[model samples]
Target: MNWQDQYQRWKNDQDLEPQLKEALHNMNENEIEAAFSGTLEFGTGGMRGVLGPGTNRMNVYTVRKAAKGLALYLEEQGMADRGVAVAYDSRYQSREFAVETAKVLGVHGIKTYVFTGVRPTPTLSFAVRHLEAGAGVMITASHNPPEYNGYKVYNEQGAQLPPAQADQMIEQVNTVADELAIAVKDQSEIEAEGLINWIDEAVDEAYLRELKSITYRDDVKRDLSIVFTSLHGTAHNLATRSLAQAGFDHVFAVSEQVEEDPEFSTVKSPNPEEHQAFEYAIAKGQDVDADVLVATDPDADRLGVAAKKADGEYHVLTGNQLGALMLDYKLANMDDVPRNSVMINTIVTSQLGKAVADHYNVTTEHTLTGFKFIAEKIEEYNQSGAHEFVFGYEESYGYLVEDFARDKDAIQSTLLACEMAAYYREQGMTLFDALEQFFERHGYYFEDLHSLKLEGTDGPEQINAIMEDFRFNPVEGAIAVEDYLTGKRTYLESGESVDLNLPASNVVKFWLDDDTWCCLRPSGTEPKMKFYFAVKGETREAADERLKQLKDRVLERL
Candidate 1:
């Protein structure tokens, strides 16, 4: 049916919400056309969009539709009694969305475990597994600007529903129309029916205990003076308590950002990947004569750090650099750790990680973008007894030291980072100097990321076009181009082909001479096409220069 016809049907339906009808009455033709242009897409991660009064927007009604669909899907699986866990981050309507999800599940006769307040995304993942539930929901837009909010679905293993299963869920979401007609049990009814319960301190204690085991050297955390900031997100309480419990003496929380603020008023953006999020933490570090500064994203899954360098200046380490440092620390301090330990990272992460893993004689695995893929690998290793998973990270600021939560965990990462900083301090060296020493042992590898933001309906098409152009027209002076979507690698010079073992994605990568490579892929959660560049040289300047040139080339194509 045409979108306008669907809009007409919705308007004539008596069960549709009156407020939505009123909003539509004020909309002009173009606005109506945009609102009903298509069904809101549910991706592998789940639904995310701007909050407004449209079929495609994230409002009370749209959220109800998502919840109803999910509840129906669970009922179809014959596992509705297994229950579903729900948690929300500090974003607009997050708490409301959580309640909506719980009520919908309860209406379908499925049990629901809802966190009382905002919590990190990883904690939700852990809750799903801990409760042995059928599914989980996390209401968050992560590091995106304040205008957006998201709903993420998790499967039995506490990983995000992979693409194939997510597609089925999306079909269910599309099958619903009248959001007001969606039936949800009242909160009191749900609670009385024994389908709704609140989770609090017990879950926190269990997760923190699991995180504590990830610390290879808790002794090193004894006397660390660190400045920690949550960037006005959900990590304040747990991160601070974890540090103190791990025996750290002087953990300073940035007072301005400790409280949860949906607007994230302290920073321009809540993304830890950006330097701006660390501004307050950095200043606090200076004032307190701290050794290191750490900041977690709004969801508290990804972490970023700033350390005092040998030159008496502070340098904010990139995600790749921090991963390398942690890998080195874990490997060197592995006296009690098993010899068959393993490391995992996304394919687009810096090759320097691979180099560091190789130096320690540890095996490293590669996965696609999401940390769920890494979690899946950890599950695989645990079952097979193939290798002990030591650490996992992605260049996009996601890292995991243990399989506790089966996702990127800044709470654990923050504790480990401060311990690593203390270890460096004890040796009378800076993190920058340790990076330099690692460079001396291995080679200097510089990595850079470039994103092209394209909003609205045309955005995806533009991203596809750019990817298609690269796949057809190989980069200049490239040795091989790997097209992950097709699962094929075409050698530009040799004219040979190979198969890619990873899961399929609309991503294209080129391997240039001298270990320089560039990759192109669309943002899974945002309207952006991201480019990843990694190059190696003897010095930072030379490597940075090469990366800049390659980035320019990719941007031109984008």
Candidate 2:
């Protein structure tokens, strides 16, 4: 059906939800068109969109359709008896959507273990494995804005659904013809039938117990004065509690952002990737004379850090910098360096980490953009024993030190960052100093990311046009091009082609002269096209200049 007809159908429905009905009555022509243009795309990342009453939004009906699709997929796989785990963060309507998902699954005779309250995304990943569920569902948008919400599905391995399985699930989701027509049992009815199991502290304690194993040192100075903020998301309690339990004596929680505020009133955005998100934490850090400042997103799956410089100013570290720091620290402190140990990162990540891994004699592997790909590699290593997984990270402030949770874990990363800071403080150094040392050794590797927010009906088309333009048009000074969509790497000089040996994705990377590289990829979870640039030079000034030139040149073409 056309969007106009769909909008009218929704407008004429007598039994429409009151909130939706009100929203429909208030929407303008453009709003109506945006809402009914098409169904929200449910791919490997599951569904994420603005929370409203529309096929394209993240309302209860859309969520129910997703749950029903997952239910059908599970039943088809004959794994319904194994049940599914459900968790949500502190976003608005997150709990309601999570319960709605369980209800839909329950009506299909599928058992569900649902968290009673807010939990981090990584904890949900852990619950899938700890409960031995066939799959897992997380109601979150990660670090999206207040108006946004999302749904992410995970497989039995406690990892987000990889491409192959995600394709199957997407087909099932597409078969769900009508969003509003899916049936769901009442919460009470599901509870009485023993299909809904409420999980709380038992799982929390289990997850915390497993987290204890991530600590690498017992004698590291725990007196590191630290400032932490959850940005009014789900990690407020657990993050602070984990620090205390780890014997960190001087930890200060940003009081303004310590509670669960769905609106995230304290900050403009809850994403730890942005420097603005750490305003409250930075203020608290200065007040307490903290050795380091840490912030986690609403779902607590990504971590961000800022360290006090010698000049007494706080400097926010990029995701790559923090990843390198953590990897170096972890490898240096390991009692035995296994010859077969390997570190994993995405194609868009900086090569500085690989240099760090190389120094420790630990191999480094590259995966696609998503953490699910990294988790897949970890699972493969676990099964074949070809390599032991040490650490996994991406360029988007996501890191997983231990594989206890098959996703980026901000809680454990926070602990380790604190420990690393404390250890460095004992040597009269800060994280900035440590990072500078890495640069001096690794040739001043600098990196930056540019995200273009091409949203709405024409957004996808425009993004595709840009991708096509870059695919055929060779950039100046480029030596080779790696097109993940074609799974081929072509050398410009020799016209030789080779396989990337990685999963096919809509990503294009350029290898330029002077040890410079850049990548272009669309965000799976957001309506944005991201440009990642990295360069290496003998000095910081040269590296910074090269990085700016590369970034400006690439963006000008767009």
Candidate 3:
């Protein structure tokens, strides 16, 4: 059916929610068309959308449908007997969604473990593995605005379902012909029947126990002064507790954003990717002369840091810089660690991390642009015993040191960052000075990210057009192009194309002369097209300028 048919169905339905019916009655034809034009597609990260009525929205009926489909998929996988773990963030209707998911799965006779309250994404991943469940669900949109919520699926391995599995799940989600027909048990009935169990402190304690192993130097934590903010999400107590447990004495929390708020009252966006999220943390850091400022996104899966620079002002470190520092520290300190240790990072991340890994004589592997890919790699290594999993990170402020959880952990990252600061202080050098030394030894590598926001309706088409332009037209200053979707690299000069072994994704990267490169990929979690530029030069300033030039040249085309 077309938009008109869906709109008519909504208008004629008696079971539709009242507010949604009122909104639909008030909407114009164009608005109605947009709302019912298509079903919200579930990507590798799962479904996320505005909380309202429509095929494009996330609501109870939609949640029921997704859960029913997920249940069917799990049953087919012979995982119905293994059960599932469920967790949620502090988004509006998040708890409702979590309970609703449990109800649907329970009605299917699949046992479910639901958190008693809001929790982080990594904890949910850990719960799946710890409980020996077949799968997991996290009801969150990560750092998206309060208006949005999401549903994420994890496999038995504790990683987000890979692309192929996600496609299978999506097919199941699409197969539910009637949303209202999805089976669900009464909440009280499910609880009484013991089909749904509530998990609380035990999971948290086990997760923290795993984090203790991340400490490289016990002495460094004692002297580190760290400021951390959770941006009004679920990470407040967990991060602070982890820091103190790691022996960090002087740690401050942002008072205003410490409490759980679905609206994320303090900051415009809860995302760590935005520098504005660090405003409160930065001010507190300056007031106390903190060694570093750390902020976690909602659900505590991503980490961002602000450090005091040589110029005596606080500067936010990009994901790449922080990843480099942590990679170096983790690899160098692995004196007694397994010799075949491996570190994983995304393809779009800074090549500087690869350099650091090479310096430590550790293998660095590149994956598709998500922490799930990194987690998948970790599971692979753990099973094969061919490589020891060391560290994993991505360019978007996501880092995982210990695989206690199958996802990034801001709590673990915060403690480790503080420890690194203390260690550098004992060495009589600041992190900024250490960064400079690193640049001098390795060639100066600077990276810049440009996000082009294209709002609703035609946004996806516009993003696709932009990607198509690059795929067809040879980049002016590029010597080669790596198209991830086709899993091949095209060399312009030699007219040679080599197969790239990584998983397929809609990403195009240009490799230029002089160690300069640019990459283009649509944001999986937002309505934006992201461009990444990396440049190398003799000095940091020169490299930054070159990076800016490259960004300007590519963005102009967009």
Can you write out model 1's per-residue Cα lDDT over 1-558, one digit (the tens) per residue?
Answer: 566876787678776567767877788877777777775667788889876567767877778888888887787777687899999999988998898888887777888899898889889888888889998999999998898999988887788887767877888887886675788788999888888899988888888887777567756636777888888899998888888878887889999999899899989999989988888987888899888889999999999999887676667899999999998898888765577888999879998898998888889898888887888888888999999998899998888876777878898888878888888888888788899988888888998888889987898898888888888988877899988998888898778999988889988889998879998889887889888899998887888788888888777754
* Residue runs of model 3 more than 4 Å from their true location after superposition: 18-30
Please give the lDDT score at residue 68 for candidate 3.
90
lDDT, each prediction: 0.85, 0.91, 0.87
**Each prediction's Cα RMSD?**
2.0, 1.1, 1.6
Clashing pairs for model 3 are: none
TM-score of 1: 0.95
Please, what are the lDDT tens digits per residue for candidate 3 over residues 1-558? Answer: 788887787788888778778887888877777678887666678999988777777888888888998999998888899999999999999999999999999889999999998898888988999999999999999998889999999999788998888888888888888775677899999999899999999998998898889888655537677888989998888888887788777888888888889999989999988999999998898889898888999899899988888787888888898989988887767557677989899889988998888887789999998888998899889999989988999988988888878888787888778788788988877788788889998889898887899997789899999999999985688899999999999899898999999988899999998778989999887889888888899987889788878877887775
Q: Estimate each model's TM-score.
A: 0.95, 0.98, 0.97
TM-score-superior candidate, 1 or 2: 2
Best by TM-score: 2
Candidate 1 stretches with Cα past 4 Å from truth are 1-31, 336-339
Clashes of 3: 0
Count of backbone clashes, every candidate in sequence: 0, 0, 0
lDDT of candidate 2 over 1-558, digit per residue (tens): 888988988888887789999998999999988899888889888999998988888999999999999999998888999999999999989999989998999988999999999999999999999999999999998888899999999999999999999999998999999887889999999999999999989999998888787778888879889888889888877888888889987889899898899899999989989999988888898788888899999999999999988799888999999999999999999888789999999999999999999999999999999999999999999999999999999988999999989999999899889989989988888999899999998888999998999987689899999999999986677999999999999999999999999988899999998668998898777778999999999998999999999998999987
